[model samples]
Target chain A: MKQKIIIAFSVVLLLFAIFLIARDLFHSSHSMTDASCCGDDFTSAKQVDSTLIGYKRIRIIETGLKNLTGIAVNEKGDIFACGNMQVSIFDAAGTKTKTFNVDSVPGCIALSGNDLYLGSGSHVIHYDTIGRKLAVWKPYNNEGYIASLAVNGKYIYAADALNKRVLKYSPDGLLLQDIGKKDSITGAPGFVLPSLYFDIAFGSFNDLWVANTGRLQIENYTSNGHFQSSWGSSSFDNSGFGGCCNPAHFAILPDGGFVTYEKGIDKIKVFDPTGQFLSIVAAAGSFKGNSDFQLGNNHLVKDIAIGINGSIYVLDAYNQINVFRKKNL
Target chain B: MRSKTQIYILVLIISLLTLNLPAIQRFPRPEFEGKYQIPATQVTNIQPAILQYLDIAVLIACMSLISWFIVKRRWRKGVFWMSLFSLLYFGFYRKGCICPVGSLQNVTMALFNHAYKIPLTAVAFFTIPLGFTLFFGRTFCAGVCPLGAIQDFFAIRPVSLKPWIRYLLGLIPIVYLGLALLYAATGTDFIVCRYDPFVEIFRHNGSYFMFFIGGALLLTGIFIARPYCRFLCPYGVLLNLVSRFSKNHVSIAPGACISCKLCENACPYDAIDKPTGLSVKNDNRELIKKLIIYCLVTPLLVIICGWTISKYSGEFAQVNFKVRLANELMTIERKGEPVTPATEITTFRSSGKPVENLYREAASIVDRFYAGSWIMGGFIGLILGITLARLTIYKYRKEYLVNKGNCLSCARCLEYCPVK
Candidate 1:
């Protein structure tokens, strides 16, 4: 009798197990067939041609380097691109010149004369133009993520995205001051860096231009880190920056205009010095399926560098450098 | 034995019929113009931390009850009820997160990565079970572990496997433990949690392939008897080692055995050891020579195993997503093809991370795997040598005894013992 009861109990348990297995198999097969039905929907939703008027693609230079992070153009038109663990320098004619390895993955680069500064991890490494290591700067706080770099004649500024502040260092690699603190008295609203896209550039008048990404605006500060003025608006249209954080990266054009790259919509636009909306340089259609701008966080091709002759160099997410010139030029 | 065989056949027929019912039933179909949609408002309210504390308390209570039922009352029914409660609370209600089995990886990751903060509950889940097993001989496995509970319920009409086959198959859990620890320590992957078979059933959503695997395991458990616990559970390997040194363990008989041999075949797990007579008639000198030879060859076995596994370090490193992505990018670059970046590549490029740096980091991880795999292989070889040596040595016993390492403290043998 006990053995019979055990048999009945085992049969019930076995039946339940089999039921769950069959149901799961049915659901999986149904989902697999359903997924195929939506295959056409995926291809048909390709981004349309939304190219901003005025700029023309002059040349597309294949850098051959994957995961390019930062790009900077010097006065000599020498382009330096920072990627994974090494930085590659190219001449104006798009010829590779020098390549040297850094200790850590280089994040951003800034070149002043023959001195090149590369943000590798927490430290800003200074190297000579010929790829010789010159000086290693002091580690920014242990937790800081140095995402962008900008340099002038006297000081080098590192946009520490993780700390949400900018560390200003003297030419000799001495810590000078921390900027962009949330101080109501100084009226510094602070830099809002939700992700690691904080970028900085030195303007024509030596003003520090910082991409306050989270607020969807660019703020200018004096050489000594005083809050100056800011301009930008959040909009999904072509007139303003949009998405979770607009203008993920920016560079100062020679004419004091701003070349800004918005991540989610993957558009590169030009703004006047007063932050007035200018013409579009590159549109979302140009990037096509290359950008990842889903939801709030956009991780697309970043960093814009303006060449000496006014040619705009944009690094796509895959590290391919796209050079855009004025249409009539 | 005749009735047991008859019951097994009867149960098998019923189960097969139950499985065939879906194919036999034909219902009138209802047509729809478009896909059927069920509007599900998924309001995911994060459960409070205090509730997690309550779960810890319940786990403690279950373990205590299981220990009492096994050691004092010698009641298998009590253990089964406690196991059912564990399956409901930990498996169904808690969705099997923070389980001691998965907590092994968290504890391992915390030991290696300083930045990783193991939650207090995870530490509690990990240590408490091992602590209980040290004194009570796997009361946690007998009742409190949801993974074990779910499997134990399906284990009926289990046939005893050959001793040699059991010994060989038993080596798998050690290998699994080695691989899990290697992956966790090197920050490669949490293979245990990622490949947890039954977690999908508990959570009600997972990979389709994993669901099939889970169902297949439960089906196998019907005849194999706790297949996951005996062969695949890395934490069970730890418990097996800890239970060996346990001060108290479940005994087959409540008092005297009387050498009746009735309870000899009672344990489906083959944990009951038949009594060996007072003396052995084997040649002692030959046995001593074989033991010495085995001891000398053990290190050589370790070296060969370590070297062989280390050769496949590159393949093992593929378990890491970064290493795999870096390898893919490198392969594309080498092929001189136009790169179409995937989502991971796009994310990597947008983060301004360096490709050379990624490659270098991946190479370093591959090196770590080379060393880790060597350690894993050597550890397995050592375990094999020790198991072999123990099996060779014979021990004298007055009566039948429960194998401390294999007995789950379910107390099934207790009912068959006439003295009890």
Candidate 2:
């Protein structure tokens, strides 16, 4: 009798426990968190406060974007992000206006005036603000990606990182000067491992900030091809850029300050004119699948655009643009 | 007989594993319309799952071979060698998925989670071992599965419970089935997948605690006799019940048996049952009563259990948090006002911890505790149900006992008669 009673109690308990587990699973599988309730959280990226407050999170909205490589912003607070095969235009309101699709992916985008200069494999394209291909310029050998491009008064500087040289061209696509050569490290002041020199921007003193990716530092050069000082390394957390390669893509701020973004760590940090570490404007937040229809590819945060109006726009993988305007800009 | 059978079964399974099946690298000719084009199988790829199943196969083959050696050659005794081989085999090479426990886990998961990625191990273990169960009896379960193998080692020094207790313990598989389904649907850890001791033996190069647990089970298997097969495995229950109705049935078959009762004691799996010749008279009415009770109880269990599990289904995490989130991150961070890339603004962001495994992590402690107590509980219910059925059939047994009148004139009685 005692044995039977024990069995009876156990059977009831087992049945009950089984009940709870079954109930829990059924509830979890079908229900979704309300976006409005998950507001400011990643599930709800549309929760906008009227007040421009602290920046929080980034929500990825789409997937299947092929190689969203590099990003850049334009003057109208629009973003011109590119891949080797295409260029994406995202409007101020975070929607794609148009896409410039090419046979080969466009790697970098630098906006000037009302035009967007896009670097495709071995060629550079000049596109109108509305994303029409105006003209295409190909290098002589055209081997690999045209990694970086910068424009100053009809002078277009193209870094043939694969070719180990910067090809200077006129606005009409005329090749003017091909500086540096294949495998030549140009023993300039702070040159290191050279492959594809990634970024070249006309900085404070007509000093071009050459983000030498392989060397893991930013090299500065005079507009006339003279070498200047260099700052940064593959270390970034504690004043020095972290990692083994491509440390600095410093976007110079209007207040004589600078903001730098790291690719591997996925963070944007701020620095002063003297390279002193400032506040981290955005921390490494959670990434969801395919949020940006504008950010073209995964590896292209180095291509960003800051308008004079203090609005910052980022082109993500697959031509999606993440536009950030200052609270009081 | 044992050594010969073990050797035969081992050779068969090993040959089958290496046989001309659909080689993963060699893409099969398309059979279906509109199926996703199979990617050209990469030559360098050794799927993590294939290696895991092979580990189970190797463990089974090796255990049988060692068993053959121990019983015939007397090189060793007990399940020490089996436990050692499983641990070392799983440790040095295919860390843990090498056990059939994982496949059982998948079977449980499949019944609930439709989108579940069925590990090839599950299919292989199921089709092969289960085929053997239907044909040659539970030889696949007898010693091959590392869990069974380990338990076979431990059948020593058990606190022998009553047969009624043992019979009751056997009903645990049903409860496991229900719980496993709930978890799989809830997107919880495939509990059988996650914490199985034998699979754990194969995973992570053999943790200290796993060796202890595995060694304990094997030593216990020496005395307790197929404990996991008896009470724990839901798949075993499925295959066991199916094996009963299998075309190639296992029985004494009246003539083949010499009425020696040798195979009954020799059978480590306890699958051998006595013929209905000798003990037909004592209890007939009890069987009818138990049948009626079970008929009442089973429908109630099905309805009540199903209803109760469906009630609390809301709390389970919807996302399989372990899914590689590279794509997930990109979509969430897109749209509207982009946050500035100032690294200093450290806000509490959701870590890429997959939510699918979340509920399992929460329920693990409660689940494990409940699993133990429930097994005991289910066993008791089964005993009472069986006892009640025996009460209903008592009157019929008295008439059937006199001169074997209810027995068919078949020679099935000759096997059990010592007088023969």
Candidate 3:
């Protein structure tokens, strides 16, 4: 009988505790709905900016491209975009010209003369301008991803973001030297990639430029794999690179400047040869529905390219290439 | 009749052979002519909301049935079958997500963080077992909990541990509960779910080390009888307290006590308490004096324990990612090291959040740990004092009694009762 009394008292106490918890849970569920009253409807780019800062929206080309990973333009102004296990060629006017099916999805594409280089899976494949396969480069020890590709007169550079190293290869696909390994003797600080946004571009003098995204710096390396200098700043403001890694995609302008595209705050900015922030071609607000996208692949720059006439083409998260030209001020 | 040694060898041989059967059956793969494409597999078929409701309903039903079998029907076989059903439905089918043990963290998080909303199912999962235990004594542990049920299946050829060792190891659950609650309340990590030994086995895909740990625990369970539940499960610490105040618990005998001592060695978990031969007239005065002294000294014990644990509050706070990242960045800065920042550090810097703000937040978390550890230590001290007091005092009994706090309510002792 005494045991029963103790148990009854404890049961009442537990019941009261349960009642309090239930009430709080009920209130939380209702309050959560009220807090997110504005559903996830994204603000469109048209609504955010009537004029996309010093650039006119010349074209909104619609391509049936999914996972549009890489975009490049050749001397002939032909635009090449690779994704969805295929490489597509578009004329200067955004008309699809030809498509070549590939075995694996290419992470990046680079154009030299008439030869198109593709960083697909762990191997680089070369093809003629007319889509005929040329040579399959010997497979390199790619850790997991081949994130970016760059081609110069004598060498091809593949940025292996997974291994956090850049591989310089001969035109015939023989691995030459591994760049970006931390070496005190060479005074190279190596690459701080963080996420898969390692981009490499060839300068006019055949110098190599790699984006050490984690450090928010673009590193300049000599053709012989020597670190020259690096410049960028980690800041939330307009002048600096922001997020874990940014300038996810960038193309070399004709005059040796860089047209860089950033994720998280989806924007396009131009930098001069000396790595100074030149001007904002497009602000983050110019892209619709990207404000809430977090810093990752889902919100990363899919691809970027520059036409011969200095038009900036940006393949955004939505797979639409927005061509921006200089506005007549 | 077979000897105990012979039975042990036989069971070991059978278990070993069962474990080795997979290696023995090596089949060749069939060749296909056309190109083969693997079908895309959906991770989960059921909607999470609907599945949560179903899980709660099943938990309530299983708890009631387990209590009925152990207390009213006194059927060990019935309880065993129910446990098997629980292992199938809650363990394999549900993939071990909406579990009461892990839900303890969710409840703690909700209580501490007003902005954090816990699913209604998680609250029910946490509270229902406690409510049931207050009335019926750990019916959830008996069969409803899939973790317990899976271990119970392997609890064959069990060995009894020494009372001193059992008491010493019993302190681990209280400490684990404290750390789990501390981490959860501060939004650091869910240590319970992360370290759950049996969940890997249920899911069939998890960290490789966890799989080995699960296998090792199952091997230990073959001899130790629900080792995780006795020594590690933080939720078990909560259940043990509620069960002590249970209104009705399983008794060894259904009718009159014959004192035949048949159930003395029956319990594999060593939950049976022997009768105390002390009479009220002899040891009453000395026992009362000692109990009063222990009660008076318990507060001092609490303060001492709290101080000792608080000294390591900074170390404990490192379990949070932000605190850890800040510490790493500070270390790198102090050393002037040229090492590349990790992904987490890069993300933090890229997000443009103020580094000083991160340091301040880490300091505040350390403060929370200091206070939480003190309360946890004080709690353990109180339990220790109560345990000592209970042991020194005497209770008059003629028959074997189940230790309410320790009993799993598995109903195994019911079969040994002669008066039934």
Better of 1 and 2 by TM-score: 1
lDDT tens digits, residue span A1-329, model 2: 76455444544443444344344434333322121111123212221122213232243323234556666665566555666477666665556677767656667777778877877778888877766778988674758567778876668888776776677888888888875432336557433333353667766555566666555556666666756566664443436454324443556666655666655344555566666765554433343332222221122454455656545555443334455544333
Root-mean-square deviation (CA) per prediction: 12.7, 15.0, 18.9
What is the C-alpha lDDT profile of model 3 across A1-329, one tens digit per residue?
65445434433432343344324323322222122211111112112232335566678778777667778888777788888888888888889999888777787898888888888877788887777887877665744468888888778898888878888889888888888988888778877765788888888788999988877778899988899988777654546675447667778887888887765455667888888777666653334333321222223357788877788887765566778777773
Residues B334-388 of candidate 1: C-alpha lDDT, one tens digit per residue: 8753322344554665566679999999888888889998998888888867776
Candidate ranking under DockQ, highest first, comes to: 2, 1, 3
Q: How far is A235's C-alpha from truth in model 2 (Å)?
A: 13
- Once fitted onto the true fold, the runs of candidate 1 whose alpha carbons sit more than 4 angstroms away are A1-329, B1-47, B277-281
- Each prediction's Cα lDDT score? 0.75, 0.49, 0.74
> Which tens-of-lDDT digit does each residue in B1-420 have in candidate 2?
534544554454335334534544211131211212322221232457556656557744754554343333323232334444543454324444435555666665676568877766667665665665555444444335555544543443333345566556665666665455545554556755543545444332234444444444443454555555566676666666555544433233323445455433433334334445446655656666667777678545544544444442322223233221221233335643234321111111212244445434544533433443344344435544544554455333211111111111112222333432
Using TM-score as the measure, the top candidate is 1
Please name the candidate that would achieve the greatest lDDT relative to the true structure: 1
Question: To one decimal, what is the Cα RMSD in angstroms of model 1 from the true structure?
Answer: 12.7
Which residue segments of model 2 deviate by more than 4 Å?
Answer: A1-70, A73-268, A271-279, A282-329, B1-92, B98-101, B104-122, B154-156, B179-191, B205-229, B245-280, B289-301, B308-420
**Model 2 Cα shift for residue B90 (angstroms):** 6.7
- Candidate 1 residue-wise lDDT, A196-217, digit = tens: 8898998999999888887778
Candidate 1 vs 3: which has more TM-score? 1
Clashes of 3: 1
Can you list the residue pairs that collide in candidate 3? A243-B350
